[model samples]
Target: MTEALSSLAEAFKNVGVSRAYGTPVKVVGEELIPVALVSFGFGGGGNSEAEGADAAGLESVAGGGGGGFVLPLGVYCRNGSGHVAFRPNMIALIGTLVPLVCAVGFTARGILRTLRR
Candidate 1:
């Protein structure tokens, strides 16, 4: 289990915010650098059992699993004025904000109820 966790930690060493930014591309004399939202998760577990008393035992069991995903947020591009700007994906922004908005609304509702009481 220690080795498994150690390897998982090592895997993340090279993954950072910079990984979310893609290399720049040039089109029509303009440079565009893509940016994205990145997230990752990892987990591990183990189990062991003894079959008998003294001098008798069974081998241990172990398992591990991990997964990750990324979402393209938008890109940084130079406008006609030659100034760099960020242009976001409306749908992605909405999707990211909806859950946050719902959480805030629920918290506010709970607070209002408590105040009234």
Candidate 2:
């Protein structure tokens, strides 16, 4: 599980450029699970301050977006009767919702700003 999480993080870091971020996996019972919360941020900027200055002759225009995900802990069992059962644990529900909500708010703010200008 650790290796898998490490690999995932490394992959994100490689492809995400400067804003790839991930959390370590957590273990519950016999299952290795994601940390329940993971986030990603993306932005674009000039290669140098001079280029930004030359383009805008003021401040460079940059934008960033972020989003997150949640994973819940669960349990599965099978009995001799061949019945299956599942259970969910609450941990990251709010964590996941908050980031999404914030992202939406940020998006709205950006749109409003653009409209105002």
Candidate 3:
């Protein structure tokens, strides 16, 4: 329907990379925007049966679902000197780093073993 399409267009207009950045807040002498990584997904399907649609004249059984996640990554802060800096979320940093460190460690171990052999 045109109404549905127009609403969808409006939703997309409001949803974008900017959503990952939060409104600026001031703490002490600095202004900070809490930043996060954002993601979303959607899926839909429909199956039509004549028996299900006889009276209504609508045939297709339609369904859709979606999900999203936002992970706080850091903040962009502007200090008194008018300089901006990124301050990372330490826990999130470590959470990402551990897996990457493990992968690199395993790769290095494999390479060393192959060289020795």
Candidate 4:
């Protein structure tokens, strides 16, 4: 059980969400697993009109791309003793990559604009 919990914690730590509360670490049969339930929260502090416009822009871009990955960790335990394992959901990975891709795209666009001028 200790080893299983250690392994499960290690996995979550790698993903930078280990600090998130309510993260489940469990053992099933011979497997140690981590499960997470995520819900996005939209803040109201931003300018309402700007927020709406930004949402619209995101919706348009979202339609053109494949839906993002959503990784949910669900640990299942029956009795007590079990192995340690995890299935990584890559939605966060995709979310991370999007900003990187956009940065590259904007840089390329800027270079092109500079060359054209």
Candidate 5:
């Protein structure tokens, strides 16, 4: 199990910002670089048990699993005249920020109550 987790960690070390940036594609004299949000997780578990009267001792089991997701966040585009701009996907932005906003709101509420007390 340890070895499995170690390999998973090593594999993830290669996942960086480069993975979020797609190859630039040019269309109608405009270059567009698609961007994304990438996320992944890994887990492993092991179990050991003593064998019943027949086998005396020793049984072991191990399991590991991993999954990942990529979400399109939008693109950076440059026109023929070299004017560059970024366009974001509103749905992804909202999905990513909702939790953060809630956390901030909760912290602010706590601070306000503490100050009032």
Candidate 6:
């Protein structure tokens, strides 16, 4: 278990800021540092015995999982005047916003129903 936990910790370290920033690319006399929103997680499978259930119970296999997402947020680019500015990835931003908007709309509908009661 210690080894597994240690490995997970190392995995998180590798997934940190290093993955969020990319190698700088120079284009047309401008330098751009690509940026991304990185996210990840790890989980250890649960034990059926902890809940005091039968050894052959349905919860015997609590499968654990690890996953990650890297969404390119945009880049830090140096303009002609040497000022660094952030230019967002509109497509990725819109992809994220669509779900957010839907969630807000659903939440608003629930709140409106509660208020009407």
TM-score winner: 1
How does residue 108 of candidate 3 score in lDDT?
100
TM-score of each: 0.73, 0.30, 0.69, 0.32, 0.68, 0.71
How do the residues 1-117 of candidate 1 rate in per-residue lDDT, one tens digit apiece? 888898889879999878899998998877899899788888888766644423455467678888888898998998567899899988899999999999999999999999999
Pairs of colliding residues, candidate 2: none
Candidate 2, residue 90: how far the Cα is off, in Å: 2.2
Q: Where does model 6 exceed 4 Å of error?
A: 1-4, 45-64
lDDT of 5 at 59: 70
Pairing residues by index, what is the TM-score of model 4? 0.32
| Poorest stretch of ten by lDDT in candidate 4 | 59-68
- Please give the distance, in angstroms, between residue 11's alpha carbon in candidate 1 and its true position after superposition: 4.3
> How far is 14's C-alpha from truth in model 6 (Å)?
3.9
- Which of the predicted structures, 5 or 6, would earn the higher lDDT when compared with the native? 5
lDDT of each: 0.86, 0.50, 0.85, 0.49, 0.88, 0.84
| Candidate 2 off by > 4 Å | 1-72, 77-81
TM-score of 1: 0.73
Which ranges of candidate 4 are over 4 A from the true structure?
Answer: 1-24, 27-30, 33-87
Task: Return the TM-score for candidate 3, rounded to 2 decimals.
Answer: 0.69
Q: How much is the lDDT of residue 19 in candidate 6?
A: 89
Candidate 4 local lDDT, 51-88, one digit each (tens): 46775764222111112233454444334534344444
Q: Candidate 3, which segments miss by more than 4 Å at Cα?
A: 1-9, 49-59, 105-117
Top lDDT hit = 5
lDDT of 3 by residue, 1-116 (tens): 34555565677677877889999999999999999999986656666875759698796677666688888999999999999999999999999899999999999999999999
lDDT of 6 by residue, 1-109 (tens): 5567788787676666778999999999899999999877778765655554665455454556688888999999997899999999999999989999999999999
Model 2 agreement with the true structure over 1-117: per-residue lDDT tens digits: 345455556766654412222343334423222222235544334433555587677654443343554355444444445465544445455665788999999999999999999
